[model samples]
Target: MHICHVNLASGFSGGERQTLTLIKQQLAMGYQLTVVANPKSPFADEIRALEQCQLVLCKHYTRSHQRSITADCDVVHVHEGRAIYWALLQRLIHGVPYIVTRRIDNPLKRKWLSQLAYTRASTLVGLSSEIVRQITLRHPQANVATIPSSPVQYPVSNTDVDAIKAQFANKFLVIQAANMYAHKGFDVTIGAAKELEKHSPQVHICLLGDGKARAELEKQAQGLGNISFMGKQSAMGNWFAAADLLVHPSYSEGLGSVILEAMATGLPAVGTKAGGIPDIINHETNGYLIPSGDQGEITYAQISVNPLIPASTICSK
Candidate 1:
């Protein structure tokens, strides 16, 4: 089938990465794949690398752009929120079937436009059960499907991994890789780190990824020697390999793909019991699950300081 993927995000994040993964898999399965993405986006650059996939550069999600790009496609698969509106427009104009992959746990605005976007789609895909529940709760008649995002196995060079290992050799490193957003729960992570600073001096918390809340989070974590912000990083494999554990304290999530990526890299995670985190982390088995918001302190304290072993090893025993 000819599948057209629409993602208008300008930056590369979990949603963009998921779009790349889906396109790659679809191409491998012999489907004719095309991507309609922003002209100056990382998603477009990566999609260009794949010779088999067709890339259509769209400066904006306009009706003319959507019509011209999706004319020959059998199915339109949208990967971002704004693209859903464009897809709905396409359905109205061209009689094309479109499916949307909603990746966030934020509630849809109670507006006619947002309501129509969800209700009129051919199918709505939620990255987690919680997201599905939220959508169905809002519009019971909406056809929602649950398909979690897949983790990409990053190819980190041995040199990079060894360098990270050497730099933080003495400290028991715990990494949290997510945009510094309020819902990402960096505040809870900072609070947990502050508490750990007084007691577990041996444990160091590294905050990866940057967003609007960086300055505020950094200020809140001041005078704490154990907590450090590493900013946005592309070489995540090195960090995962060097760290002893991963902690994701998001207040809301669609599916915690970072947790899955950490798990794939043999790092155990401590994620909050919010959104789709529970679907990825089996509490105390793969990782610990804490209550959302201010309840992370008690759960964070329960995690052992011992070096994390691979989940495969734990499963075998």
Candidate 2:
């Protein structure tokens, strides 16, 4: 089957990474694939690099040009939220069928335009059960499916891991890899880190990824020697290998892909009981699940010291 994937996001994030994975796997299976993305986005650059895939650059993916780009494809797969509207337009203009993948747990607006988009989709895929429930509640007649995001795996040499460990010697490393968004709850993480410092001076918190809230979060974490901001690092596996635990205090999430990545590295996580975190983390078994923005203290003693599994074992399942 010929599938055309549509994603209009300019920045590279979890959704874009998932789209790239799907394109690569489908092409390897002897399926014809095409990707419609912004001309200037990193996603388009990666798609252009693939030999068997076709790349179509649409700056806005406007309605007038949708038919020309997707007319020959058997299925239109929308990977991002903005592309849903474009798919709806194509379905109306050229009688094309399209499916949407919803990646966020945010509630859909109850407006007529949003409702029409959901109701008209051939299929709606949610990354987690919570997202599926929200979509079905908003539009009862909408066709929805649940398909989780794939786990991310990367190689980390023992030399690299040892180097990182030496850099943060005599410290219990705790890492959180997420953008500095309010919904991500970085403030809550800082608060917990501050309290933990008062008791366990050996505990160190590393904040990964960059966002608009970086400066503000840095200021909030000021005068706290235990907390450090490392900005965005391309090689995340090295950091995961160096860390003892992962803390994801997100207020909202469709599914926590970072948590899965941590699990794949045999690192236990301490995430909030929000969205799909509970689905991946078995509380007290694999990791700990705390309430969102809870003022209660979390110490190194609360974190699990046992390794879950090797990277290959977790990824294979």
Candidate 3:
């Protein structure tokens, strides 16, 4: 079966990476696959690098040019919102099955057009149960299935924890690894960090990932010595290993996969009780779930960071 995957976003992020991981696993299962992505996208080259996978380029997948995607393919799997137009056309024109992985939980998306697109999908995959519930609640007949995104790489191994801890030695580290989207609640974290800094001078917060809100978030951290923005890093494993805790203040999420990674690393997490986060994190067990927006510097300390599995076991696999 030829499964054609489509995601025409200009940039690559966690969702794109997770989609590639899924496709790679499916390819390993002996399915013939092709990836249709924007040629200019960073992910395009990577997809082309993969063995036995065809890479096709579409200029910009929009509703206007949807009919052009009717080319032969057994299944078309769309990774995000941008691929929806083409995916719908394929299903309508060629009667081909299409699956969509809705990666974001946007409250603003509660509209008739959104519901129509969602209800029309052959199979809709929601990253978190909360997303599934939201869809089913709005459009009762919406076909939705909950499938969590996979980890960055399975069998996470222990690597350079001592050196990482040494980077912020004698200081409490709270790491937030998310793009600077407004929904990510960076401003709230900044407020928390500021208050925490005043109470405990040794408390340090590290903000990772890049996005539109970076500039504003940096300004919010002004005069706050404890807060540091370490931009995006290719290797988040060491950062996750090094941190004393992980904090996610997102207003919503499809499923906070990073929370799972933090848990798998045995790092205790503190996050907002919104969207599918509650599904992965059992409050006070693996992490703490706080209220959204305007919450104070609720520091969660002395919690256990999940012990890393020895590298020997993972590498052997």
Candidate-wise lDDT, in order: 0.81, 0.81, 0.75
What RMSD value applies to candidate 2? 5.5
Whose TM-score is higher: candidate 2's or candidate 3's? 2
Local accuracy of candidate 3 as per-residue lDDT tens digits, 143-197: 7788998777534245566776777888878888998899998888888776666
**lDDT digits (tens) for residues 1-317 of candidate 1:** 89989988888888888888888888899999878888778989999999898888876767345466777899999975678877888888888888988887878779898788777888888889998888888888888899988888787788988887787778788888998888898888778777666656767788998999999998999898888889999989888888888888888888899999999989888888899999998887888877888634533432453444223322211
**Where does model 3 exceed 4 Å of error?**
62-72, 107-116, 154-163, 300-317
The TM-score ranking, best first, is 1, 2, 3
TM-scores, one per candidate:
0.92, 0.91, 0.85
| Candidate 2 to truth, TM | 0.91
State the displacement of the C-alpha of residue 314, model 3, in Å, after optimal TM-score superposition: 38
Q: Poorest 10 consecutive residues of model 3 by lDDT?
A: 308-317
Q: Where is model 2 poorest over a 10-residue stretch in terms of lDDT?
A: 308-317
TM-score of 1: 0.92
